[model samples]
Target: MISHFVNRKRELERLEREWKNVPSFVVVYGRRRIGKTRLLVEFSKNKNTFFHTFFEGTKESHIKALRKELAEFFSDEIFLSLNDYYTIFRYLADKIDAKTLIVLDEFTYALKGDKELASKLQRAWDHHLSKKPVMLVVSGSLIGMMRDEVLSYSSPLYGRRTAGFMLRPLGLFDSLELFENFEYGIRTYMLLGGIPSYLIVASKYRSIKELLKWEFLTPEGFFYDEPYILLSQELRELKLYFSILSAIAVGKTRISEIGNHIGVEARKLYPYLENLIRLGFVKREVPVIGKKNKGVYKLNDPMLLTWFSMIYPHKTEIETGVIDIENLRDELKKVMALRFEEVAKEFLVEINKRERLPFKFERIGRWWRKGEEIDLIALNEKERKALFVEVKWKDLNEREAKRILRDLELKAELVGLNGWEKFYGLVAKKVDDKKELSEEGFSVWDLADFKRFISLRGEV
Candidate 1:
């Protein structure tokens, strides 16, 4: 079942209203399955429009397709004989005395053979359609191309666009619409992320585990090549990127450690890491509360992380139908547990960006020194203060959490906050509700408090 389109009304309204303004060209782009088409469809449902998706076709082939669309809308004799897109756009600009919405999906593909296509469109807009009553949307999936060709500083359309949209995957709240329960579903979402196309194939009818199996195990399943499809466009060294991403997914966060596992020099990995960061799939961050140079990196796309950690290593098992679900369960569950706390951090940080925090920190990250290690550090960069947070998904028991906290505090003391402020913090699967926090003199942010922090602060 499709979850109700619960958010992004503002984005929708902005696109809907674009026709009222001059220079109404919008560039909407994102990674595959991120609902770019859906958002447009949602807007298109309320308008009169020309919508065309460009893919896997030669320029002549695309022109022919455009001709067919024009022929059907106007007539073969009137419009099909036209060869140039500029002329067609020029002519159509006059057809509508009122608002018209034109969606050119996968616009990069349309411009692939003709690097001058953006320039051509600009000429058409300036010479003819500039005075027309229309809103034009150019959408694409290749982020590098979209940014360089359409949105780049040197491109002809650089300053011509009235609005820009890079649609993102659905969030934690959106997942609630997809699942009946919170706990089990969060884990599933941690595996698949918020890609709409994946959600289309994920079992809305079955248990979460069953859906995951269908997504990853069954040879003919829709998402069998989903991760590969998404990664191929953005990364050239698939194996190395896979190894590094898998290592991170399975729970190593440090650069040196990830390099060690991937058998690459840390210096060699920088370009790949930077590309992933730009693609919005991975992140490099320093402690929100600690030293600026001491930083860690993690996979930002939950599905990619989950795919590399669990799916890639288990591909052979799925191929032979020899996969033991129970055996797979034990191994994947272990990986999941290791990665779960990191997911908790993302869930926390995503929420915390929305508002003022009790800690009032400027940054949040994992921290390590030549000797000491800490799970999380949130620094109030302005105040020069820091909060040390340790997450426990394994030992929710009070004594176990307390032991972790004690070690975390010791670790924090070893690495002085570079003459900044001081605060010790602990986070867990379930903070010991019975443990009197103010009495203990240690500030504790339990799961509820962490979730509250996110809810109150997460602006985007």
Candidate 2:
């Protein structure tokens, strides 16, 4: 499938500004397949660049390869005999006279091969490279290793970096370019997510079912072992992490429920849960109404959530060739509904960015009280203004929409905003006579309205 670079305006702008500053050291990191390498390559364009991608190998082998690259770049066989990275770094620092960009992509692999590489690089920076006009860019996929080795307070390179950017998956609006419909885009955002590699593979497929068949359902599919690989890269105890993630994926949101599922106590799971949260795989959230005690945990990565919820649980069935894609398709509708709520929240944020909401809200999130839940609430506590919203993923007729709005008003009262100036909104797949509802003094939106608003703002 044809793929095009969508947008990284903020990152690109930051890198451009760094390029103007001499003797800059920048650290760029993110999870694997999140486009860290692509971003570095994009930033290195039209500049004097020395780009080296460290792969799985021994330190001697990688150093030899790096020596060859340097020898070729400088047209000198002198670099051929260089033994270590320190000497190589000194050579580079001494040779380069002009502004240059040096990108060490996947630098974690080199660190894995040799633990001393970070200190060596730190020495090189202090004694040689820092005196030059070189802009050093180090990028890594292993978040934990990169943080400990390059960014932690105790590391040799600590306090030396001029800037650091942690790249995240693209947002819903940026990901819409991969799909033809708002519905499809929302579904994709909830499933494969906004990771560019996943989106590129998705753009080749016609639908989520097809994408799953090609990349997940089959034993030899690209994503069949993705969770295993991802877990192995950053984690030590694979089985424990897998169990925790599986429990979280299968409707076990509370800490107690997850602990029960994994046969562990709630307090004992904090380390694993905290690590997962740090890795961006799981998220911990508290209710908006009562933030004192009640909280829940959920899988943050859509791809991982889908794998644990579907493919991982049924791995034996899939491997034995008895898996039914149609059955999975039937279940996907329910899964898509939960994801639609997330997309609806993102949609509101996008419109909020355009100042299209009733009043600008500083916070938008799901609020819950006992058994009562509001899908989306945008509020500005300082101004005492709140927008209460209900997100429905199904088509809603005018009567059904009005009933939901009425229920929302009651729910808003339960939110305990006595003096707040409140507004009501309903987001649905299809809201019959949404304009009429909007004219009736409530802010109402449907998929078509959301699509049109996004298109008008040049976001799609």
Candidate 3:
């Protein structure tokens, strides 16, 4: 199995810092399969830890399971018979004289099993666990439940946490560690979007085509029904949400477009779209230099994007055992091309971090008005400077590269940044004579630069 623990140094360091501060209540939450439990397990190494995972069962069952685990850890027969949360916390507060880590993974499961679990934990922490030199870490996979029951201001545990953060999926640079070939790594990233568990499974396959056939195209495949399962876990009105996602995945970006496609009124989609945005499944974007109210929605999760684009459209044939790889090739390429723009943006962000860009951009995003659009625009508003770029998923010779750059400049002029220091650039899969283009004062980059950057960072 691929190591899912490769790129969590920063998260580990944060946990270490929290460990140094006793009586810490740390809340770590994210979507399912984003590796919250793995991160906590890594942090618990060599420490005095009592780790227990809660399940979807009765409150008494949850208490009994935790008590059993604690009974073994503390070697105290009394804990085995303990029937309540308060007494457990009271016992820990009294027994844990030294620094200790107490991790409650999937705490939301227990919370759902008992509606008053959060309030009960709040009472336990306030009356018993607060004075102890313990770091109590609780993590959950259900984003909406976690926020409502633990992190929201209306929650009983509000203002009680010492630290909290949503664990995000791995970025491009860190995700490259999973594959030997840079090109394949990019493709896998486009398909899976850096979720560690998914990347681990993807890494085991020889090629994307093979991986898709066995893991995605077949009904018995691991990912064939993944999106359905994921949606069912955290959402009600499954059909509407599925239709909304399907619409966005197929390029119905505007609220009007999505609503029309899904056969709902535009205004009614706001709540559903907001929920998806909050759950990290969909994202809304406005032009970097345009009216804020003019926003468009897109599928934020790469897996869902791939599923809706490639699998959902061909679901009938696949379910009937007709797996046509060749027929799906063009669709996959289209998805890759769309995702390559995002990859290009990520590359520029990394470069900006190292101060390698012409000037440090305060914001970066796609820019458009009317029909003319730029693939990316990096702006340093304080300095009144903008960098406009056109991204392509093709191998471009010098002439083609210059033509793109020229078109980019023309588009930049239409953006109405007349007084701003405007610079033009091009990014592509491959660009011949990149050095010559760079010498001509264009910010040029290709796959070679990406490879070099990964190698230099020692991530390969």
Candidate 4:
């Protein structure tokens, strides 16, 4: 809708290249309304393709609709209508006699409605469509269904895809371009992440307070029912998960404390916490370099975090006016700024990927153990070496950087001999103009470094 501008250029290019290759099946996924459909369409505009959408309807009705759409692409094939769902595969085999692009959008819907869809697809593809000479794309919105129904190792269509794209929200740097100024841009982004719909509603040059009054605090607003809608789609036991999220957003992260605060036993909350982490809305952290089981969780989505931390709890305020709305709003903003440190670490993680440290890292998480903690930890498990990092949101004066360096030196010494080979990096959002960073003992990074990482072709 917005001219499909900026970011994901590499992904588009790769997709285009694959479309021209010998038979390739691609699975494209992301949260709903995230421009996944727009991207697929834009990339396939001039290509010979069959695109179809599945919606909430009976299986026979969907098959009839799909056959009708497929018939649009085939001029000579005597395909009046398609039945016996398996015949759709036969139809494809007949139609793609030459090279073609075939798109199945909202595939999760089909799989949801017809439990045998993946097996049906597998049969059709293997028996009739595999060598038909075409590029195939299966895209969906319901993340859990897409993974378990079609992509899991045990699924019928598993391993059929030549490549897959797990499309993520837009980057903050490119995302900020929608707003007029840095302040509104940041606040808007802080709340909305990079989801296209949420960003479309963000006001330019408005104070955070004005934005809430004008855009958010309303019945018809974009985010008014967002958390509920998102949660309802993704979670089954929604209330407990939401309660835990609200507790963390309100600053109760310790296992015992969050459990006590939310009236959930610590053990019962683990599944919800794990799910939140997998969804990228919440983070679990341990005290520096701790194991997976030994960490605390923090609210990772600032907007939703702020929403639950402030807005949700104040639902009655709209009717009763029992709370000081302005004070609550101000406190929410203050706490969010404090939480921006975690956001900064996420930015640094992206930079490390671009640098391509000597090791190939499958996962990069932060670490903390006892009195020692690194703001970011990039572990190249293949090489068994880790990059411990310090991230500062403030600009580092010469004195400040020196002090950080000294403290790092002490920590490194305490970490012992093997820690020398463990790379140490320092990152800041802003730093005084002093010198080029690589000259220093530690690898230094800032916003420029971050922008450079995403700029790399095929990097994201």
- Candidate maximizing lDDT: 3
Every candidate's lDDT: 0.73, 0.88, 0.90, 0.71
lDDT of 1: 0.73
| Candidate 3 lDDT tens digits, 1-460 | 4674778888898999999988899999999999999999999999999999998889889998998888899889888877878778788678888889999999999888888878888988988788888899999998999999999999999999999999999999899888877787888998889899998888888789988999999998889999988888899999999999999988899999998998999999999999999999999999998899888898899999999999998999998987677889888988888898999999999989888889999999998889988999999999999999999999999999999898888888888987999888888999999889989999999988998998667533
Residue-wise lDDT of candidate 1 within 301-359, one digit each (tens)? Answer: 86776566666788898889877456567656665665666765666566456543456
Prediction RMSDs, each to the true structure: 3.7, 1.6, 1.5, 4.7
Per-residue lDDT of 163-260 in model 4, one digit per residue for the tens?
88788887776776666566566556766677766776664426777667555565555666788887787788887887888788777878788999
Q: In terms of TM-score, how similar is model 3 to the real structure?
A: 0.97
- lDDT for predicted candidate 3 compared with the true structure: 0.90
TM agreement with the true structure for every prediction: 0.85, 0.97, 0.97, 0.79
TM-score, structure 1 vs. true: 0.85
Segments in model 1 whose C-alpha atoms lie over 4 Å from true places: 13-17, 73-77, 203-208, 235-240, 243-269, 289-297, 329-331, 346-357, 383-385, 418-424, 432-435, 438-460
Model 2 lDDT, residue 305, Cα: 81
Tens digits of per-residue lDDT for model 2 on 42-153? 8889999999999999999999999999999889899999999999999999989989999999999999999999999999999999999999999999999999999999
Q: How far does residue 374 in candidate 3 sit from its true spot (Å)?
A: 0.3
Q: Please list the residue runs of candidate 3 whose C-alpha ends up more than 4 Å from where it truly belongs after superposition.
A: 458-460
Clashing pairs in 3: none
Higher-lDDT candidate of 1 and 2: 2
Provide the lowest-lDDT 10-residue window in model 3.
451-460
